[model samples]
Target chain A: MRLRNGPAASVRYEGILRICAIGLAVFSLLSWLLLGANRGWTKTTRTRWQKDPVTEIEGPLIEKAFLPGVDLLAVGLSGALILFVVSLLVTKNKTNSNQVNSSS
Target chain B: MKNKFVAALGFIALAATAFAAPLEFDFKDPKGVNNVIFKTDAPLESINGTATGISGNVTFDPDNPGAVKGKIVVQSASLHLGNPMQKEHLHSDKWLDVTRYPEITFEVESAKNVKTEGNVTTADVGGKMSLHGATKPITVPVKMTFLKDKLKARTGKEGDLLVIRANFKIRRSDFRINPGQMEDKVSDDIELNLSIAGAAPRG
Candidate 1:
């Protein structure tokens, strides 16, 4: 049987992309919270104005960030997450147009 | 005879003042003991490091603490970031470019808003600090203690030691360090904490 580009089929495909986007967003937020909490991050928030010890993690010449328990690899994963969200957006828009055309 | 005594006293007074004037200091060996420290509080984890090879001197006055001037320099290549690759990335051409700009210098031009409390004196210090190949005028709040305080602490004879504890903040954007990366994770304002305890000239 042929996979038809019908309105119903397009909606189903778009549903998957929409769900993926939401799932990725939720994952990032949760990682930021749970991972941040895991790495000994305090409950209080810190701003730039308050003076933190110079001896703490970030030094003069280098700056590397990771979620609490996760190390540098977390940065690469975050980048991938961003790409996934962008891809989902593009695919969903394409699916929407396809549905409109088939319905018309 | 009385006139002669007064002239003799005047000569000694001049000599003492000259001796009490600012004396310069050279950086100590293995400069890692006293160095430049920087820290950033990111959402993920805090990143920190220290740059050694700290070289420079201060012309500090024990007699008149307000009259002080000097510059401290941190060798870029000597920075210890705890990771060889991370250190390399920081010193790379994109960042500090250790080859092109090998040093970050903080020149203390003068001191202002000077006030003293017992053995401790605090001042608003004016200086020009250059970082990442960019130089800017900066005034930092500093607390100073004459070496004599050390002598007092030890109940020993007062010698030539001056302690300067200066903590200040500068925006990384001010020096154009990856300024275009608006989404950078590092904090824009960088905290600089310097503790320099060494000798000075005292008449």
Candidate 2:
């Protein structure tokens, strides 16, 4: 009795990867929301520029607004999500190949 | 009548001859000026850089020993780390917040001359360091060389910039930056280095 490389295995892998991707996306989004709700970024930008020529020219320059930790988390989670999606696609392709081979 | 007239004339002449002296700096030609460098070390990496803004007067009179005082303010936000991500993190809200508190100011509290070693004049300078909206007292050991029309004081330099250098750690949490998810990723202790140069007055 041969173990089948069929729809069952593909479905399981797909489900797992989807769950992982969703979890990471949710975590990243939640962090962004929580950070905003806490007004953490607000503290850094509270100072207003006076109407001075130097400030007028430089004030519009946008600096890094995300906290280091949050930025890291967001990047890390984004990478993981991308990898998982890629892996899911690869697994689906492999499963299709196996199905074709069995039919032939 | 002739003697009384001469006495009044002599007193007036002596008073008129007195002249106000110009500001004289003992170290007229500072070996170096406007050269100060600060560095930080971390487990993952180390960051080191020099500051461009330095202005102050140093009047050292051995006999009279007049007070020597000055102020140094480094644009905290201008500090550059090798990594752009790290630099951004440093200036972000979780760290230095360079936008809101753009400058790291250090005002000389006191400069006491230590034992003279050859031409080098070592002074312990006490001052307040304001960073991240918090001010803390810091003492910097400064070795100054009096050059013609310049005063060169250095903290750390090895083929990079100067000689005078200091190493101290500052906890980000102490300045009200608490550790949390993203904040916890970075080390609390940060190292600082100060290298400075100033124009020496001409005789």
Candidate 3:
């Protein structure tokens, strides 16, 4: 099959970028929620550890380690989303300009 | 009347002393007790690993609610993962580049006692997390217990060992680990989990 040219290609590119942008946004939001939720879980666990004075039977192992510079990851993801959107907009604008120029 | 005043002052001082609890950690244990785990969602064949050879100090006084101080560091090159091929790939120029960036460090900002129930005290420890070459501010919920000379801590528990547990998603692109030709195979969002244990302090 022959591939579409000019406007078609641009359209496909824009669509891919838009999808990527949305995906990144959703991923970032979910990350924030998970972190917050984990914090809540930690609080509850601490309460349980203190209140329920039971035997230390090694129920389930608890993992606690810091991810150095994680905030940068969040910020960087945000930036990537922004860049993806901007590129799509710029590509669409250029496509429109080319179409107008050709028509004129 | 005079005796009552002195008794009240003494009570306050005693309460303050009872609240102070400081502990140190040694990471020489081979049971994976002191290892630090880090995760990233980048869809690369391998982007997650564990860091061992940890050595640090943590001094915390829960009673005062403001005297918490500590520093921890993990040798960056010590990070190990599932397979040998993956390990070599990670240490290569594509990811950690272990030869260049050798250590991940954390500097304590402030530790505040959020809630205390009996012997267990939960504190919100805010500080800077540095990895690769970037540093960011992060707040970790640290639950600690003072047992004689040994101190045990539980953080971010998801059916894992207690000491430190963190779950945060990161983008590999941020650290300049872009998916150039094989973008589809590798994901940009990476989820991280960390579990660490520290040794108790000595007199």
Candidate 4:
């Protein structure tokens, strides 16, 4: 079976990959901005409690410091980075393949 | 007539001495267990935080729970969020402005509908809540538990302990906290939960 190794096909494929990568990155950036751009780990739980040793009283000791949408930012950015790297690799392969084919 | 008046005064003084005075429980817990949790839920976001710098005094009389009175003060700076940027914004002028208002205070004026069961007493507490440079009258449902001679067990000091728990809601607009702003991300109604244990150590 023959593969689609034409220059135009390769170029079109690379363009699609690049466009998808950029879209992912833009979406991640916008989501992060909207979520307040948390610099720490994301959390969703509403409340936490700590028990006092002396008083033996349990009360809300911590609250959700990271907002709800922060996790979305983290996941989105990570996915965008992966896609961007994949796109870069795809473009590099296409260039290498074209150079070899022209030389042959 | 003079002799009778002297005798009456003596009797009155003896009676007063026999009546126990209300115990002043100090809410400044060295154990750092006293805390106030606040939450506000909106369509776009839910904001929650905890304040641990609590200090105040409440005069509680086990025999008369309805007569409870005191003040609770929370340091405005102690209101904390998990995110540093969000925490800073909360304390900024756009929100609480902690520098301008150094403290959030509640002065208990009266208690009503008090009912005592075992060591716990429940009541409707009326007080003046001062927050964000505004003071407003509010009523909250409070549950107080009097632990006689329990201070020694908790703090290794011979004393009595009073545990107080309350759940209430307040309107941020009432305190002029960025009124009519951020209603979508931050709700106007703020729910507060208070838990504290006050100790009155004895010699």
TM-score for each model: 0.60, 0.48, 0.50, 0.73
The prediction achieving the highest lDDT against the true structure is 4
The worst-scoring run of ten residues by lDDT in candidate 2 chain B lies at B153-162
Candidate order by TM-score, highest to lowest?
4, 1, 3, 2
Q: Compose the digit string of candidate 3's lDDT tens values, residues B82-183.
A: 445556777887776768878777777887656667655667778887766777777777665533433323322221121443445555565566445455
Model 2 spans > 4 angstroms off: A1-104, B1-38, B42-50, B56-59, B62-66, B149-167, B177-185
Q: How do the residues A41-91 of candidate 1 rate in per-residue lDDT, one tens digit apiece?
A: 222222222221221112232334443334433653575566566556656
Candidate number with greatest DockQ? 4
Best by TM-score: 4
lDDT winner between 3 and 4, please give it: 4
DockQ for all models, in order?
A: 0.04, 0.03, 0.02, 0.24
- Per-residue alpha-carbon lDDT of candidate 4 for residues B40-156, written as tens digits (9 for 90 to 100): 998888877889899999999988889999999999999977756678889999999999999999999999899999989999999999999999999999999999999998878
> What are the clashing pairs of model 4?
A65-B82
The CAPRI class of candidate 2 is incorrect
Q: Rank the models by lDDT, top first.
A: 4, 1, 3, 2
lDDT of 3 at B185: 49
Give one clash count per candidate, in the order shown: 6, 24, 25, 1
Better of 2 and 4 by lDDT: 4
Full-model lDDT, candidate 3? 0.55
Overall local distance difference test of candidate 2 = 0.51
Cα lDDT tens digits, model 2, B1-203, are 89989998987876654432223332111232333344545455445444443434444433222244545566766665434555688779767787888777666667665645544567776777777788888777766543322222222221111123234566666676654324334556665654443332332
